[model samples]
Target: MSDSSTAAEQTYRVVRNDEEQFSIWWAGRALPDGWYPEGTEGSRDECLARIAEVWTDMRPLSLRRRMEEATAG
Candidate 1:
């Protein structure tokens, strides 16, 4: 109902897992296992913007590596 509360609700952080997938997580909450912060924190839109900018490759890291290996051989 207040601007401050609304802003607080919008706060988020960018997180990534071992697979290198990008996602937004609520700030101040415990990150799930294997998920670590990607160091960008701000409103939901800001976090998502960062993800869009950096996560151009949608493939998971392991999958990409395997695909490269298969091609190289």
Candidate 2:
């Protein structure tokens, strides 16, 4: 369960088009809603970090609760 659940909770990624249009995907599935960065003026790493921050903000409470349960289990 740990191994498989960890696999399921792995990081998701955002892919952008040449036009800056993009979509979100998680665990091989497309996220229902699309997303785009709202700020500018940074290095590539900074941009990626911002994306990560957004991802964390959108993380599911179900995942967090499951992780806590896994740890407690």
Q: Which one wins on lDDT?
A: 1
Regions of candidate 2 where Cα sits further than 4 Å from its true position: 1-37, 57-73
Clashing pairs in 1: none
Could you tell me how far off, in angstroms, the CA of residue 61 lies in candidate 1 after the best superposition? 0.8
- Taking all chains together, each candidate's TM-score versus the true structure is 0.87, 0.27
Clashes by residue pair, model 2: none
CA-lDDT, candidates in order: 0.94, 0.51
Q: Model 2 residue 71 lDDT?
A: 100
Instruction: Give lDDT tens digits, candidate 1, residues 28-50.
Output: 99999999999999998899999
RMSD of 2: 14.9
Superposed Cα deviation of residue 34, candidate 2 (Å): 9.2
lDDT per residue for candidate 2 within 1-73, as digits (tens), equals 6977764556555554333443444434444444433443244444456666654434355666778899999
Runs in model 1 deviating more than 4 A are 2-9
User: Each candidate: RMSD to true structure?
Assistant: 2.5, 14.9
Cα error of candidate 2 at position 72, Å: 29
Looking at model 2, residue 66 earns an lDDT score of: 79
